[model samples]
Target: MAWGESGELFAINGDDLLTLSLEDQTVETRASDLKKDSPQHLPFSGANILFDIAVGPDGTAFVAYYGNRQLLAVSPAGVVSVLVQSESPWSPHGVDVWGDYVYFLESTVGGRPRWKFWGKDRIAPRVRRVSVGTSTLETIYDGL
Candidate 1:
């Protein structure tokens, strides 16, 4: 769960992105199933297992999609987009947004069936960040 600067609380339940208005005390589903941003018509892969959520200053919600290893962005109007993608065994684990970038964590599943483990997939853990405005990806400490 995360609180947006616009006074809305954002959360992910299953495949549904929910937004709760603190003022009016109303809850709304921003996006569901995340089908709009899916890669293909996958049977098992299409199921989105949302992990963490972060709301930007402009009310855009960033989510860590664990199932298919994707970081998604949901607009204030509930439009969804696949912001960043990771390869198999390496899934997006955590997410947060600050000023000009959306911070995220990508970790390996290590062949876990139910997305249970966070072991390295024979790869060293690295650090990176994506710029919000220009959408440029800058690597900080990529095993360098």
Candidate 2:
């Protein structure tokens, strides 16, 4: 769970994104029904597993969608939108917001089902960040 700068606490429960109030202790749904039904265009199949959430300065939550290999933004009013999506085989995870960028971790594999225990050295993990309002990604660290 992560506490937003705007006093809201964010967490991922199953496929749902939940926000909680510290003062009133109220819980609200930010997003839900995150699972995918059919394999259409994206590299992965099955349900969308939300990995991590980062609350932006404007109180919007930037979520790392592992199954879809994309970043999603949840507004303060609970509107969900895709921030960016990668056509590659990487799956995004571990998100945080700092300064002008939203930093996250990406696995070389697409999803958990496709993951293997050995021969993973060739599949390098990366620490990447994207500028707000742009889909352009910048690598902070690679081969980690």
Task: Name the top lDDT candidate.
Answer: 2
The local distance difference test score of model 1 is 0.72
| Candidate 2 per-residue lDDT over residues 107-127, each given as its tens digit | 775234443534553345778
Query: Candidate 2: where are CA atoms >4 Å away?
Result: 39-47, 110-123
lDDT of 1 by residue, 22-99 (tens): 899999999988634664422144445677898888888998876766788999888888888765545665788867
TM-scores of the candidates are: 0.77, 0.79
Query: What lDDT is obtained when candidate 2 is compared to the true structure?
Result: 0.76
Cα lDDT for residue 76, candidate 1: 87
Candidate 1: the clashing residue pairs are: none
